[model samples]
Target: MQTSPKPKLLIFDVNGTLLNMDGIKTAINQAYQHPGAFTQWFSWLLQYSLVDTVTKTYHPFSEIAEAALQMTAASLKVNVDAVFMQDILKSMQQLPPHPDILTGLDLLKKAGYKMVTLTNSASAAQKKQLEFAQLNAYFEETFSVDAVELYKPHPKTYQYVLDELNFDPQETMLIAAHGWDVAGAARAGLQTAFIARDGQALYPLAKKPEFVCADLHELAVQLAAL
Candidate 1:
């Protein structure tokens, strides 16, 4: 496999990449009293993200979460208070990182790579989530699509990270679990790494990433060799 020179900057996606949000899925199912409640909300979240990107409409990630939850509740024929929905959304702030994340991030830092987090989440929630995970110190910056009023898979969202960091896409590597995210970054000219967190499939027609690893630690080792 071809490898570029050492990366000057490493960008990570939050959900399903560093953090395991399966707890949120369980919470959603429990709160809605339905087995598919979590899947429903997740699908709606993606839908709204696409809508926001295409329409140039923006809402805080928390608001999107609440709105998606409400939609899920309505579809399940259940009634939930708006305040209660907000509480559930706030629970996202308490998610923890995967087992390999901190150690992998430590190794990357020791190898002298600059690291940042890029997420589609709102800034406040992303901060809270990282702080709770105790991995906040590993990153020099946390970027959210909230700044651009768009979501990932949108070229502008990835461009926002490059613009803020003032780094060329060629020198930056985007590490993500979602195929769409990796594909978008690759399209934007950033080298990409695919972390197979849940055996999720990549976009069949998307530009393939430079590397694929089972988890963050493996990705770190591959990067260290570059």
Candidate 2:
């Protein structure tokens, strides 16, 4: 088994990493009247987030989600209006964490691991999301990519967190459900734990994550042992 020297800081990715987006998926399906619109919308949201990063354009995550929803609605020949998009955005803030989250996070907290969240969601939305999910107590800090005007998968965003927390890359472990995020942290020099949520897969060319667990519960046990 691979064992890491216990890290000084554990930085988590929000969204699908810590929180469940099943509600948002249901919302999309209901609004678009299409069973597959949810998946397509999420893919487009992530795609355009990177597009903005690569093209030097910046928009808050909520805006990107809204735009993605409109595009998804249009593609499906569904006349989803701005009001429906706004409702979706509001629902996003109220999502619950995955079922494994509470026990997993509690285990880490009890073990004296310092935890924080690093998210693409901007400050206000990030706070609301965490608070709504009742996850605010587990994290010591919540960071957003907006601080550096770059999103995850960009080295600057990771560096910004490390810099603010006064921790070296080697002293940190980035825990995420997205392979692209794990790849980014690996490139930035942090150890990574990939939570292989259903429908998520690692990139073939990306560096292997130092740890791979089926969910946060499994990850918690491994981290506690370390």
Candidate 3:
């Protein structure tokens, strides 16, 4: 438990951290004609996100979603239309929060921690997801890497949020369920809290998070204690 001095701003990753997107995984598989198609698409989505980031090419997350789906479909030897792909993405916007998210975020807000979301999704899409989960009001701001034309694991993307909020890296903590995101923030010189959702392993290339918890409520309690 490496506790930093009290944090002035808390930046959170949207997907997997606060929101429960398991349903979206089901929806994607159902939309595609394969059992593991959703997983393949998601993996490729990450690959493409990194490619776009490293190449300095920008694409909306929605576009990445579509491309990944198409590539996955191709790999599976199936064909899908743009309209069907759009449906899959629209379904993503309807995902609900994890069971403990609302109560936890409310508690943190009351504790005077400034909460903001930093996501890879586009601003409109991110807003729709948060709004659907009823988690929007708890946040001071919602940010998307789309504005910076890059994605996470890129140091520049994490830096963009700090720059936009006028926050010092040391004063802001990036909380996320994804280990790569934790790594990226750490590289950018921000403290990190890892919410261990889905039992994903930590990144080998990056420093471990300052705090690791089972979920957002546990993290909220820890942050409040600080």
Candidate 4:
């Protein structure tokens, strides 16, 4: 690990890191009523988001999610119309914060670390999510890939924040629960910390983040020592 000075800002990935996705997962699983529908749909959501970036196209994250759900429905021979798919995805807007989110964010806030959000979701949806989760108050600013019409793990997305937010890459830390996210930040020249949420791990081929923690609370504890 590299010894670095404290960061000026913390960039967070909202979907699975701060906001728990369990509610949305349950909604998808129940709507499809299949054994692994949620997992499959979620995997496709991620794949299509990256596909959007590679193809140089952009759509709101919810649209990609609905498309993924459509694919899952077809694969399982379950028929669902656009309205039903939309209804199922509304669960995403209502996801609750992780149990330790308040404590973790509060610690960072009191310690004088500036915080912000960088999400793939559209600005409107991101607002709804944070409001619903009651986590909107902690962040100083919120960013969406929509600003640049790109998705995460794309260098431009990280760069956009650095430019628009006027922060040095070395002075920003991207904290996320997904391996691809931390890897992306590391390659972007920003510091990173991997929150090892359920079933998440680091990519062996990518530059590793400076910190690997079990959750945001552990991240606070670890950063406190530094």
User: Which candidate, 2 or 3, would have the higher TM-score against the true structure?
Assistant: 2
**Number of the candidate with higher lDDT, 1 or 3:** 1
Q: How far is candidate 2 from the true structure (C-alpha RMSD, Å)?
A: 1.1
Candidate 2 per-residue lDDT over residues 1-226, each given as its tens digit? 6666678899999999999998888878988898899999989998999999999999998899989998998899989888888989998888899999999999999989999999999889999999999999999999999998888899989999999989999889999999999999999999999999998999879889888999999999988987
Model 4, residue 11: displacement in angstroms? Answer: 0.3
Candidate 2 backbone collisions, by pair: none
Worst 10 residues of 1 by lDDT: 82-91
Cα lDDT tens digits for candidate 4, 71-100? 999998987678878787787888889998
| Model 4 global lDDT (CA atoms, 0 to 1) | 0.89
Candidate 1 ranges with C-alpha deviation above 4 Å: none
- Per-candidate TM equals 0.94, 0.97, 0.94, 0.95
lDDT of 1 by residue, 31-68 (tens): 78998898889879888978877897887767777789
Q: Please tell me which model should have the higher lDDT, number 1 or number 4.
A: 4
Cand. 3 TM to true fold = 0.94
* Cα error, candidate 3, residue 225 (Å): 1.3
The TM-score of candidate 2 is 0.97
User: What C-alpha lDDT do the candidate models reach, one value each?
Assistant: 0.86, 0.92, 0.85, 0.89
Candidate 3 stretches with Cα past 4 Å from truth are: 31-33
Clashes of each: 0, 0, 0, 0
TM-score ranking, best first: 2, 4, 3, 1
Where's the lowest-lDDT run of ten residues in candidate 2? 1-10
